[model samples]
Each structure stands twice: as C-alpha cells, then as structure tokens.
Target: MDSQRRQLHLFFLPYLAQGHMIPAIDMAKLFASKGLKISIVTTPLHASLLSKTIEKGKTLGFKLDVLIIEFPCVQVGLPNGFESYHMATSPDLRQKFLKATTILEHPLGELLQEHRPDCLVASVMFPWATVVARKFGIPRLIFHATSFFSICTSECLRLYEPHKNISSDSEPFIIPNFPNEIKLTRKQLPELFTQKVNDAGLMELYKQVIEAELTSYGAIFNSFYELEPAYADYYKRVLGRKAWHIGPVSLCNKENEDKARRGKEASIHGHECLKWLNSKEPNSVVYVCFGSMANFNDSQLMEIAMGLEASQQQFIWVVKREKNGGGKEEWLPEGFEKRVEGNGLIIRGWAPQVLILDHEAVGGFVTHCGWNSTLEGVAAGVPMVTWPVSAEQFYNEKLVTQVLRIGVGVGAQQWVRFLGDSIRREAIEKGLLRIMVGEEAEEMRSRARELGKMGNRAIEEGGSSYSDLNALIDNLRSHSFAVEE
Candidate 1:
C-alpha cells in the first residue's frame, strides 16, 4: 500500500481516565491529518464523549467513527455509564474495567470482522485486548497509558515471585531495574498488586503483564526521546520489539479546535476557566491541576492551601468536591481568599487544562505529575512544581527534577507519600519562591522551554517522532500487504 491510497484502521481501548482519553483522541486526530480512515472503539459512556468530540474533530482534518460497546461494570458492582473520571468510585474501577474486558472479545470480534481494521491497539491496563487480537490473528499493540517507568516496574514485578509471607497490608518487595533510585510502598502501586485476583469468577482480567506481553505485536508509549530516552532504550532492549514513542499528543488539540473557539467538548464550566486565563498576564500565572483520577484528603488539602497562601504566588488549584473534601476558602488561612482574590483561581471540578497550559499567562504548573499533565506541561513550554499524589507519579517527578532538570518536586527525599507528615505554609511558600526566581530554578525553566520546543518538533511534519511512527507502520506491514497510509 502506498501513502495516499493506504486505508489504515486502529482499535483504541483506554483505561477510561482523562489522561488516557485525551491522548487516544489526539492520536485519532493525527491519523486523520494524514488522510487515514479512523475508527475508535470504546464503552458506550466513552462513546458519548467521543461522539461529542468528533464534532470538534471536523474542524481539524478528522472525524471519529465510534464503535460503542456495552459496559459490564454493573456486574462488578459499579453503576453503568459512569463518566471517564470516576474518583470516589475508583476502588471498584479496576474490577469494572476487568468485567468490561470480558465483554470486549465477542463485541470487538464482531466489529473487527465487519470493519476489518488494520490493527488493534489496547491500553496497557486492558489485559484482554492483546489476547483477542492474538486469537483473531490481528496485529496488536499496547498503549502505555502511564510511562516507561510504570512498564519497567510492572515487568520486573511479573518476573518476581510472590513470597506469600505478607498480610493484606504488608507491602510487596520492590522490584529491581527501576531507575532514579526511589522507594515504592504498597500504597503507591496499583491496588491490584495488593489483592488476590479472582480469575474464576469476578472479572477474568489479565492481571499479569507477562500474559499481555506475549500477546501484543508491539507497544505504543506517548512520550518522546528527550524526556525518557534511557528508559525507552531499556524498554525496547528488554521487550525485544519496537516500542514506539510518538507523543505530545495534546498538541493535536490545536488541530481539533473550531473556528468558533470551541475546544472539542469544552464544557461551559471549562470555557469559563479559559476565559479567566485569557485575562491573566503573560507567563505570570501558575496553572494548577491534578488530573481527574487523584483526590486529596482534607488535611493534605488544607496544608496545600496554606502553602499557596504563604507563597504569595499567582496560582490555580483543581480539586473534586467530595461531600467531605474541604471547602475552597475553608482550607485557606482566614481571609486568605479575600487577600488573593485577584491573584489566584481555585477551580474545583473540571477545567479546560490543555487550554490553560497553552495560554500565554501560564508560566508554571503545579501538578501531581500524571503522565497526561506532565506531557502537556512540557509541551506547553511551562516549568513545573511537582507534588506527586500517587502511583508512578513519584518516578515521573524524578524524571522532571533529577534526570531532565525541568521541574522541582516538593519533598527533598522521595517520600512518595507523607500523609501523616505535612508540607506547611513556609515550606510551600519557599519552594514556590525558589521555583520562580532562584538561579537553579531559572535553569529548570530554560530546560522546560527547550523540551517544549523539542516536543512540538517531534510531532511536526518532518520530526523524529513522526519518523518513528512511520517506521513502526512500515515495519508492521513488512510481512503483510503493506502498511496503511
């Protein structure tokens, strides 16, 4: 198949989180830009979101063709049709996801036979994807929703044996080959690691990476060379196949925006936030957001509020309003909200984060360092003030602060979680001050800018990331009837 005449099809299954959804959407748009046929598969709930987003895609050169599947989350004790970001309900999310996977094979098989897509790309979290692809004799690829570090840790754990000496709360032994030398606790890894999976009954999910690893044709990670070349190299060398890094997928947002200035499904609430951002000073505002999945307890929330108050910096904070999650002003020092009224924006619930980061007013981002937020921050050319909330975010912090020198994390020691411990007002204030004006801080800002440029260039018409993507397609077709355009 030649470039223009080539008709390529891809099946995308994300873990149903904001970080995963955004990148998948972006990839869809990128393929559209190249004049390829697009079909994105998802649960009915995500299908609604995608259907709405496809209207935005028309403005770019793409239109999303969705294959909606019934979600079996009800069987897993989860309510049906829950939104992508299920915060308070996340504990049951993995199980629901696992249940949903069992439903994928039959429905997905029918869709594939009818549509005949060129390939299937499933989220790393969705273990069943690779299996069905193998049984159907289709080329399969795993999309690394987290990072190379997450994959490394997971792979190493699969290689290790469970000693069976620990109780429910006892932490598993840390695996080797994790770079940057940080410690992980049972609390930090996914809940699956702690639980005894029920393979016979509950959701027959593939909890083992080894199982999916053997089933996949390749894996696609949404990262670039500059950010994680070392780990990327190790992943490819270890996995022994092409692990492609084609990213800054968020940049495709520009390609998807409408002339009316409406972003793809930009909510009335999120647009209002964007309007506020437009009113701020160039490179003077601090954009704060924790991707949809993370939620903070009240004490931690209060400490963070006080720190922002003490920093006396212009900032924004995104939080979910759980019935008990502290109030915006309640956490701050008395009258602090009144004092910083003009300088700060405390946006609870969802916001147009991509729009905010891309704004001229955003100079720095205070984040949980989720992969989506991290890549968006770097792609926007903004430096970071990392306060990692959970999971692989601690390792991501190391990439920013230690390896790449583009961000500063709060804790000096890699205390992944310090729930009983707190970073008070003075420490938060000092950290903010140093991030903005300190010489070493300035150096970080410079690196962030460079990384931002590289990120854009990589996805551009003739860039390294673009070439890598083409190469992957080329290789995948080497044995087949040529790759799709």
Candidate 2:
C-alpha cells in the first residue's frame, strides 16, 4: 500500500487568485506529506508567487512540484503579469482576465495528456477542466475554496429561486429547505443570482461551473467536519454528491516562517509586526484586513480609518496598496497617522496574517470573511467582526455571526464588483467595540477558543480531518488499482 501510494500522482489546478491559490498550495503540500506525488499547474506569475513555499516543501522531502503555463496576456489584450483577478483593475480588464483563463484550456490539456496523473483536482472557476479530464479518463475532483454551507446555500438558491418573490433588494428572503432559517437580502446576493443571464455572460459561466461540479467525480472543501457537520452531511446525502472535508488546510503550515510566507511576503517585517504586538496587552488589539481581492474607494477607506480611530482599541490594520496610485493617500483623515501613531499600525500591503492572528496579544479580528481568513481566525481561537464584501462572503458572514455565534457583522448589506458601498464609521466602530471588549466579547471568545481547539484536534492523527484525508487517498488509490486490473 505504501509503494502504491508512492506510485500515485495528482495534479492540482488552482484558480489564479490569492484566496484560491493559497489553499490549493497547502492542500498539495498535505498530499505530498502523505506520500502522493503532487503537481500544481498554474501560470508563470502565480507560480513565482508560490516559489518559496514549493522550495520549502522540497527541502522537507515532499514530492511536490509546479507546472507553469504561459498566460495569454498578449492575445487577451491584458498587460503582462496581469494573471490574477487582483490585477484586473477595470471592468474591461476583468472581462479580459476571464477570457485569458479560458484560453489556457489548451495548454492545460497538453499538460494533463503528457503527465497522465492519477487524478485532477481543479478549481471550480475552470469548468472546462471537466471535459479535459474526461478526454483522458481521469477522475477530476472539483475544489471549492469556500465552506460547505456556502455551497449548499448557492445550490439551493439556484434550485429554488427563492429571491424572485422579494419585494425589494433590501427585503429579507428566507432560503427554503435549508437546514437553518437563513435569511438574506437580495442586495447581498452575487450579481449572477440577481442579474439577467444576457447581461454579461455571467449566468452562462455559472451554469458551466455548476455542471462541472455535477459531472466531476467528487468535490473538495477547505473545511473540517466539526465546523459544519450538518451542511457537510447534507451536501453529500441530500444533494447526492460525493464530497470530503479535509481542512483547515492552512494548518499544514507548522513553522513560523512557513506561516509568515504562506501566500506572499509580508509588507511589514515579521519582527516589527511582532514588536508592535508584544507592546499591547493580551486580547487588547484587533487585527483588520480585507483579504487579497476586495478593493474600496477612498471614501470607504476613510470610513474604516475613522471607525478604527473611534473604537479606541489598539489595532493593526492591513491596507491593500492601490495598483496605480502613488504618494500619500488622500483619503486619510487629516493628521490621522500622527494622531494614531502609537495606538495603531497601518500596514500598506500584505501582512503576515496567520502570524498576527496566532499571537496572544491579538484578541479580535476585523475580517472580510473570505473563507481562508474566516477559518484562520477560527483556528487561532479569535472572534471576528465580519465585513463581507463579495463572492460567497455574505453567506460565510451568516455562518459566523448567526450559526457559530463567534462574530459580529458590520452591517454591509450590498455586494459590488470592486468598490462596495461604504459602511459608515459608526457601524464599523460599533462592530469593533462589540467584538473587542466586555462580557459578550468574552463569551464569544470562549466559544471561538473551543472551536479552535476542535480545529486543532481535527487535523491531528485519528481526528476527523485526518481520517477524511486518508479516506480520500484510499478512494483514489482504489480507482487507480481498478484501472490497472
């Protein structure tokens, strides 16, 4: 069985986004650690971003490698190095970026044909991978970078069309047949759900993604069973699909350097960030970050700055750098930096998120509720102030604030492409105050800490995530053996 495991090879194709790429890399390393030969297929720029992690994996004797394909930047009329959604600054460029991903279908197929891996685990974004996998008789597993609850909610929305009867965008509609009495406003839904099919081909692409998941062998989620057991069970039993929950995948990074350099280099030095954190009292500082793809206009940024200032809590805020902007930020309140110099540290780019969250001094997280950040906070035992901006983030926010009861929402009721509506300073201030102090905050922290312990347990030997991973590998190996027979 050990030799058979050594013989099996798997190919992972992650969508070219930070949220998607980071988890896929971690999952690949997990597979490699289990003695499976793993190859991650991505474009050059994305590959370069993950180079350090892959080298570290090699040093640890994991059979991990990367396969790079040239992105069709020239043909798609996108600038060179514009390989990720983070770089797609305009609506026009966003369309071109989506076009570029479809163009890579051919090169990806070539890689699959040459390598003939035992299985292909591709992101849901690349629906065309289903057909490519079928051509070679390879079993493809669709990788969803969100929670089972989000996937279940999305599937229900597609099947039931529950929001159609809502009187207005702001009116709440209950999702029918869900395990929980989940109510969502029409405004919080993704554009694909609310907009016309003919608007921008979004519906067409969404249909393809759904069909790919249906046709694929099974699905993979970056969640553990204890986190969403009911939804995990419902997805397979009720939806009639094969799935596995083998995550909190970020836990695969056990070293400080690995955690610090997980996705990209930290904008601030690790030591400097640590030094600032060390100066604060335990559970006194709130760490604020909005993940990789969410962007806000100047007004929104100003509101966030004012909100943090008004909260009067110590904090470390990670602000995304503008792609094309230069010099001082015009949106900052007059003398804001000078006023909050010692009380706050505003990092202007990527911050070592896992490092900060795991620190004893950091008690609460002000997060965008991207699944990675959500689970990282859970794993770190910190409660959150949920501010979901786009994608399935609103659904995740409900899971945090409603189901898990470990977070407070910042009252963001709308979803937009890039520049979302500004949540007022008062709302942000209120959310920070709720999650960072008092009896309610302590109760939330206690619940979050227990869940964090469960997350840690789930990844250990004989734990749920550990057992599920072994089951997935055994299932794949059995399929390989059957083919050989």
Candidate 3:
C-alpha cells in the first residue's frame, strides 16, 4: 500500500490567474508532501511564477515538477507576455486571451497523453479538461477557488431561477431551497444570470464549464469542512456530487519567506512591512487590498484613500499599478502621504499579503472578497470590511458577512465586469469603523479568531482537511489499481 501510494502521480492544471494558481500550487504541495508525485501543467509565463515555490518544494524532498506548454499568444494575436487574464486590460484583449486558452487544448492533450497521471485536478475555467481526462481514462476533479456556500448558492440559483420574477434589479429575491435564507438583487448577480442578451461566446463557454463540472469525477474546494460543514454536506448530498475539502491551503506555507512569495514577488520588502506592522499596537491596523484582477478608476481610488484617512485607523493599502504606466499618484488627496506617513503604508504594487494578514497588528481586512483573499483572511482570523468587486465575489461577501458573521459589507450593490462602482468615502469609512473599532468589532474579531483556529486545526495531523486529503488520495489509488487490473 505504501509503495502504491508512492507510485501515484497527480497532475494539477490551474487557470492562468493569481487567485487560481496560488491555491492550486498549495494543493500540489500538500499532495506532494503526502508522498505522491505531483506535476503542475501550465504555460511558460505562468510556470515562471511558480519557479521559486517549486524549487522550495524540491528542497523539502517533495516530488514536485512543472510541465510547461506554450501559450498560443502569437496565434491569438496577443503580445508575448499577455498569457494570463491579469495582463488583459481591455474586453477585446481578455476575449483574445480566453481564445488563446482554448487553443491550449491541443498542447495540453499532448502532455496528458505523454505523461498520464492517475488523476487530473483542473481549474473550473478549463472545461476541455473533462474531455481530455476521459480520453485518457483518468479521473478529473473540478477545482473551484470558492466557498461551499457560494457554490451551493450558485447551484440553487441555477435550478430555481428565483430571480426571474424580480421587477427591478434592486429588488432582492430570496434564493429558494437554501439552508440559509440568502437574498440577492439582480444587479449583484453575475452577468450570466442577469444579462438579457449575454455574449454568445461567453455563454457557450459557461455552458461547457457547467457540463464539465457535471461530468467530472468530483469537485475540490479550497475550504475546510468545519468552516462550512452544512454547505459542504449539502453540496455532496443534495447536489449529488463527490466533493473534498482540503484547505485554507495557504496555511501550507508555514514560513515567512514562503508566505511572502506565495503568489508573486512582493513589491515592498517583507522585513520592512513586518517592521512597520511591529510598530503598531496589536489589532490596530486594517489591511486594505483588492485582488490582482480588480481595476478601479482614479475617482474610485481617491474615494478609497479618503475613506481610509477618515476612518482614522492604521492601514496598509496595496494599490495596483496602472496598466498604462503613468499618472499613478494623481488620485491621492494632496499631502495625503505626508499626513498619514506613520498611520498608513501605501504599497504601490503587490504586498506580502499572507504575511501582512497573519500579523497581530492587522485587526481588519478591507478586501474585494476574492476567494483566495477571503480564505486567507479566515486563516489569519481577521475580521473584514467586505467590498466585493466582480465575479463570484458578491457571493463570497455574503458568506463572510451573512453566513460567517465575521465581516461587514461596504454596501457595494452592483457587479460590473472590471471597473468597480465609485463608492463614496463615507460608506467606506463607515464599513471600516464597523469592522476595526467598537464593541461589535470586538465580537466579530472573536468569531474570526475562532474560525482561524479551526482552519489551523483542519490542516493539522488528524484534522478534517488532513483526513479528506488522505481519503482523496486513497480513493484515487484504488481507482488506479482497478484500472490496472
């Protein structure tokens, strides 16, 4: 049995985005640590991002390797480095990037044929993985970088279509047949659920993704069972799909260096950030950052800056660089940096987010509610000011604010594709105040700390996530043996 487990090889295919890739890498590391040979298949550009982490994994004696396939950037008429969705600044470029991923099917299929692993764990974006897995007689597990509650909600919305009767976008409708009485307005729903005339290409892609999930062996979530036990059971029993929860995968990175470099090289030095955090009183700082893909106009950025100032809380704000590479400082209130020099740290690009959040000084997170960010906050045991920007972020916000009760929403009511709605500084200030100060804030912090402790326990020996991971591996090994026989 030990020999068979050692012989098992699992391949992970993550989508070309930071949110997807980071968790996938962590999952791969987890599998490798358990004596399974793990291979991560991705494009050159994406592979480059994981090089450091892979080297570290190898140093720790984990049998981890990366298999790179050429991205069809030239064929799709994109620039050399425009391999990931984060690089696509416009709708046209993003569409072209999606096209390029579709083109990767041939190369990806070839790699799978050459090095057939026992199973394939693929990002939900690549629906073609289902067909490829079938061709090779390998089980494919769909990976969703989200909470069980969100997926359950999505599935419920699909089956019930409860929003169909809403006369106005602002009028809220309850999602039918859910464990929790969740309400969402049409404006907050994804375009797929709301748009009368959806983009034909996008609609088709979504259909493929859904079909892929339905036909795949099962689904893998980067969540802990204890965090959403009801939703986890509901997904498997009600939805009738095989599922596994082996995460808060970020906790796999136990070292400061690993945490700092989890996704990309931090723009600011880790030590410098730590030093700044060390100067602050415990549970006094709010860590503010939108995930890699969120784009805000200058006006919106100005509102955020002002909001942080008005809240009068110590904060570390990570500002994404402008794509065009000019006018970066135009949005700041005059003398804002000078006024808040000691009170705030404005990181121009990527900050060591995991490192920052894990600090005792980081009392609250002002976040876009991206799943990776959401889970990281949960793992860090920090309460949040939820400011969802797009995609399934609104769903995640509900999980934090409504289901978990560890976060406060900033009243962001609309879901645009890329550009965020211009929320006023007042609303932002209010949200921060609710999460960072007062009696309610203390209560929320206590809950967050408990959840964080649960997350840590889930990844430990004999914990829920640990058991799930072992079960998943054993299940795959059994399947492999059956196939051989």
Quote each prediction's TM-score: 0.84, 0.96, 0.97
lDDT per residue (tens digit) for residues 1-485 in model 3: 45365479988999999989999999999999998999999988888888999899999999999999888888989978777888887667877888888887888788888998999999999999999899999999999988899999888888899989889999999998888888999999888899653467678898899899999999999999999998999999999989999999999999999999988888899999999999999999999999998988889999999999999999999998633354447788888888999999999888899999999999999999999999999999999999888889999998999999999999899998788877999999999999888999999999999999999999999999999999998899989888887
Collision count of model 1:
0
Per-residue CA lDDT of candidate 1, range 361-391, in tens?
8888888888888888989888888877665
Clashing pairs in model 3?
A: none
Candidate 1 ranges beyond 4 A from true positions? 1-4, 59-63, 83-97, 157-207, 255-275, 322-329, 412-422, 477-479, 482-485
* Cand. 2 TM to true fold: 0.96
Residue by residue across 1-485, what tens digits does model 2's lDDT show?
45354468999999999999999989999999998999999988888888888899899999899999999999989878878888886667878888888998999889988999999999999999999999988899999999999999999999999999888999999999889999998899988888732437456678899899999999988899999998999899999999988899989888778889988888888889889998989999999999998888888989999999999999999887643364577778888888999999989889999989999999999988899999999999999999998899999999999999999999888887667667999999999999987999999999999999999999999999999999999999989888766
Where does the lowest 10-residue lDDT sum fall in candidate 2?
A: 195-204
Residue 224's lDDT within candidate 2 is 95
**Winning candidate number (TM-score):** 3
**How many backbone clashes does every candidate have?**
0, 0, 0
The best-first sequence of candidates by lDDT reads: 3, 2, 1
Error of 2 at 411 (Å): 0.8
What is the overall TM-score of model 3 with all chains considered together? 0.97
